[model samples]
Target: MSKNNKEREVTAGPVKGEFISPQELNDIEERTDALPPQEDFWKPPVRFGSVPVEKEPLGWDRRRGFRKLFPVVSLPTQVVERVSFGHPELEPNRLFWGDNLHVMRQLPSESIDLIYIDPPFFSGRQYNVIFGDQNELRSFSDIWEGGMPGYLIWLNARLYEMKRLLKKTGSIYVHCDWHASHYIKVEMDKIFGYGNFINEIVWCYETAGKSKKTFSRKHDVILLYSKTDDFYLDVSKSPMPRKRNKHMRVGVDENGREYEEKTDAKTRKVYRWYFDEGRLPFDYWTDIQFINWEAKERIGYPTQKPEPLVERIIKVSSNDEDVVADFFCGGGTSLAVAQKLKRKWIGCDQSRVAVALTADRISRLIEEEIGKIFSVPDFTVEHWGIYEADRLSKMPLDQFRAFILRAFGAVPDDSQTGIHGMKGAIPIYVGEPNQRSQVTAKEVEAFANAIRKTIRYQQDNLRDGIMLAWAFRPDAVQAAERLRDMEITDLNFVRLEQIRIDHPRFREHVAALSTDHADYANFLTFVQPPKVEVGWKRLATRSYIQADINKRTY
Candidate 1:
């Protein structure tokens, strides 16, 4: 059933109406107190069924894998940074990354308004892991070890998580092909309930590959389920189907016969239209097409879905400001369209490659004419925070060190060799969990003596007692021993942990580097049909002959 919604009520059939003598009616009404009340009789009967539940056969996990939750740190709010290329000028609401599982875990519960994920069908590992990397190719061997039952288990866990995260009013669309569509439908029905099952959409597409021996595969199944009865479906935004009458006239003829007829309001011309004309598309859809080489929006990604396709989904299922999420965000197409439509979105993908490409596409779109008109909140051009490193990297080493001492609350000293391997020139020691951000003890010892001497000299000469002197480090306990009774501002260190970077952060850096290695790189690509080459034909024929001989012998 839809989340948090109750089933419709049913009442018992009414008794036959009859007139009786007044005395008899009063006696009957009084005597009828012995009978069960009408409300009690109308209650729903208990459900009865004898259906066996399927159980999975176990014995798969011989070893457990490693799992850790480590926090990632980001620069502070006041730090302003900028980069060229790959970083999108505009921010999208949805992100599609490599691993849907990882992304889904990060999402907040009941945040999304709608979700439509077309995960792989369990159509054999060879077909499912079409991506041609060693990892994906080997995934077939690894996944098949457990078989379809195991596959069901894997999908069930994901579905459970999805159910938990969905809002009460949200909806989900699970896309699949013939291979496992039926099984998935059953599973979905069980999880979301038979009552919540919205539609079984049959999406048909054209296929040029003729199969004389069997039926041509030309359609996919989409199982739509709502979290609750209440959900947004924007009807006005959908395109009107051709061959529909523009207007209808309801009137009665001179014969006193009522009829409803299609008409053009202005011309009053009688129009013939199909019963289904101008109606919202039902479960079976035949208009959408698969991506091809000539498609204008194709960006050379293997699984890049079309813009119009996603755009239609955005318009129909969501409204402006509503959240849209995609866990397996590949090219960020959903997010891009969602942004255009003014919906907030969250997209996740594991592959660094996919994230980078998507970020680049979004950035380029913003640079064009559209970005200026629409601006997403939290992402603004006016206030890119300032990071201390960007400004310090330009200064000379000595001058930089001097500036760091005075600027970051560190004592000025010549004995100090700066901290190493920091992105910024001024190395701010990020403290451990629950500890304040501070400079290390090594630096304090090296610089405090010289910094104190410099301050003492300046203070004695200027008669202004170390006004510019400061110390920035995590452990102020030791610094107190060295600087003793002196004015020292201990700038607390930042906790490096707990910060998370957006998709654009690392992507921008990676994109700036040359990608000449990608061509030679072993990219994971999905393999389509016509896999047979010249050498393979001979091998197949030999195998066929051997199989025939074996069959004959048996």
Candidate 2:
């Protein structure tokens, strides 16, 4: 087992005050007691066994090695609204449109029962890859490259988040190619531990044509790991057939009923013969075929694995109503399977093309024609905050405030007078050059007074307070702090920002458009889904206004 690293490093926004002197810094540091070597910060600890990685040279060894050791760190206690879909009549299936690292960090630890990820394999060639629109391609290469070390770094960061998100009884299946499977296996061992190592399933499929000299490779590795010794594994559904003929029967004559199997070699006792019973499958599997162009589940995407493969995994690792997640959901294969099998699921991908296509595919799969007594869910597609706020805000004022507090990891302050930025998950407000006073302390105090009244009104009426506010701000932190402290006892506040609006120009454009169409008010409130045809123009060149303020990277 690898030793847990105990280095204490602050990796978040700086505190308000700074060290006045070297001695002051040293004194402050000395006075601070080391936090108990924190274990599993996100959720309950999951115990996983490990296994030795197979020795193989990956295409990007150096990059993978770096990633295996130092993964991307996550923002502490930040929250983003979760995106979900599927009809209420059906199970809860979600689709997240952001980075999985952030999403997993927000999720409660040990929550998901099963996870199946088909992460991008670090292959050298990628031309017209599936889900490769301009935006998606940029994100893909940004995450997948820098060679083996880079890929490992990316994978390890995600894995740490997964470790916290998984249930103690949960299991994870990591799918990969020959290019980086070995390195990934090593990383998994370090993260999940060698004791939880389960199976190395070989998904073998046939490829046409013969190799001239070397053997043609046509299989992928599925490394399975469990959270603990006692995990949920439904082996009965997909057990292998027993190879009766392969096992030699003792005490059996050449061809007669007098022959019986030997009970024990030393005892040589005759036992009733039992053969042809199905045996459980081992690590290597070769039955499932890859998706072909003519296959029913084909969705015009390269590297889309068959539904059967995912189905088998979902069935074996989880039960009905159990939540499952797939961060690298390509064509919604996992989502489709999860919906059909009655499991709650969340699938994420960077591509808008993929997201739209996945939504369409899932809808189609659910509506497959059966008979007159067909069933369909009241399906609803949602983006990020607005959709969730629409649903959650329906609760009473106190309840809604609680929801916001829990989600954002910050108490709402009614005093701040501006709409928070929805897409960026930051606190900001709309403003003009002249309306800067809207973010002042006086405004915050006034807003706080209004919230106190609203809380009282809600208490009297037994209803939730639902309202919207927007302002322009020059400083967000000071404004946010003022709001945080301006509260009547037990009555917090929530600030929501418009989703799709970017700059003041976009805000002006939206206001102009909204004035013309009152009925489309709801559409403008939430973040807009990606527009495929949008183009960009370069900004005018200018001299350096200020040096980059980012901390220097070592």
Candidate 3:
């Protein structure tokens, strides 16, 4: 699974070769599944087989009468940036900068094969603010408000969406620790059926922060769960080499391979086992070490996991060309590893700084590490709920119009001349992508005439119109006002509203949602790109400047 074989070799069992073939492994797995639960434990699982898929946004637990709810909202993506590797024809993998719950809601159901998320660990400490961004800070604050229950509720909302996005045969690996693993497990059981539980992997590593009062807490827990009963599993993908045992009776087979013989005393049947086949893994893993500050893969993210850790999970869960996703991408360790492993990936992070850093990290890998055989040629970084006006102004004309229509919750209809879209019996016109280009009186007149020629207008079904642009010329505003006044007295009355892109009413689609929570304040916000200025001055004399400022351009 990793380059450092010795460091990742947790154990080599004495009995390995007996469970190599597919038939034997399948038979063993079947028998294990048929066994009954322990008498002292194992309560019956909740029967959610008939709970319609549309109700996935509704949360529940094993006990009745208690429900945690999530609102199903669709905030489409805005392409912020696209990193290219010379292949323009390939579709770009997506990286989103937004709340993952809203982002995942827009994704197609059952599209991803593997999902690995490392969300906030609920440490309730200041160090969790790694990027110092308002969005990241808000997420951490919201989760820690009501203590354990609050944290679980916040995580369960996203977890429910993740369950909807995962394929029927997919797997999810959640990396957490002692803080709230037990609570999360019960919630996951309620979300993903309890019978689909896979393993509670213990990743052991030694680091500083040893305590004298109790045993040093050095291990992190990884809870793995599947979406369905027939999920895929291929342990041989992560092969573990075993050592030879001298006590076993070893002999060479006819094919010049080493083998061990096991004889059934009653039937006198001898079964041959091969040594080259791989061994199964233990739930307790100590081979892979934790990433220190000086590690090469470390990019300064506080909760960044090692690439090898994600690599093993991806290799075992998904195949090549399969889609992998990471909803809480801290430093994008999972995404980077997936790209190198030839798997298409999608990643989302709420912090702008983390998204920027993750994009840079992946770009560096594309330029340096992933060589000629790189199959992943492009990926796009998109923003949901939050948008960049500077980037939006630079998009192509058609792209900008489509994005505007989607953002306004309107259906784009480019078939009619001068009318770009419609929203509930109202015609809409979109201006140019360049913000400096203002809407003209001629354009407004043309849209009015075009709508008058439409069947909906002749039948008296459409009487309203909305014009969206960065700015409207005075002549255009006057034309719209004149049309509104003149048409109201005539047989067909038309109301046209000339609205700028920066108008608060432009965000009415998202603003009308339930705003009972304070976190919705940042959604549907338009942020301007920072303005940078550079100036140079003549500094002929070195003695005139300080040592620090002297090194910079003057």
How well does each candidate superpose onto the true structure, as a TM-score?
A: 0.49, 0.56, 0.64
Quote the lDDT for 244 in model 1.
Answer: 27
Q: Tell me which of candidates 1 and 3 scores higher on lDDT.
A: 3
Tens-place lDDT digits, model 2, residues 420-459: 2221222322222121123444444444444444434346
The per-residue C-alpha lDDT of model 3 at residue 255 equals 86
lDDT of 2: 0.50
Give per-residue CA lDDT, model 3, range 1-554, as digits (tens): 11221111111111122111111112223322121122312354476333322222133432321122444333456664566676757766878776777777677678899999997787885433444432223235545766787677778777866876788899999999988887787667666766878999898889878799999999988999998877887877875544466655789977899877667889988866677874566777766788977889976667888887888889999998899999989778999999899899999986555676677667767766674566555777676766655555676788778766655556799888878988777777788877578878888888888888788888874656777666677787777778878772111212112223224443332222212243332234444544211112111110100001001110
**What is model 3's C-alpha RMSD?**
14.2
Q: Worst lDDT window (10 residues) for model 3?
A: 541-550
lDDT of each: 0.44, 0.50, 0.64
Off by over 4 Å in 2: 1-91, 127-139, 241-278, 369-429, 432-554
Sort the predicted structures by lDDT, highest score first.
3, 2, 1
What candidate 1 gets wrong by more than 4 Å, as runs, is 1-51, 55-98, 125-141, 243-278, 377-554
What overall lDDT, based on C-alpha atoms, would model 1 receive against the true structure?
0.44
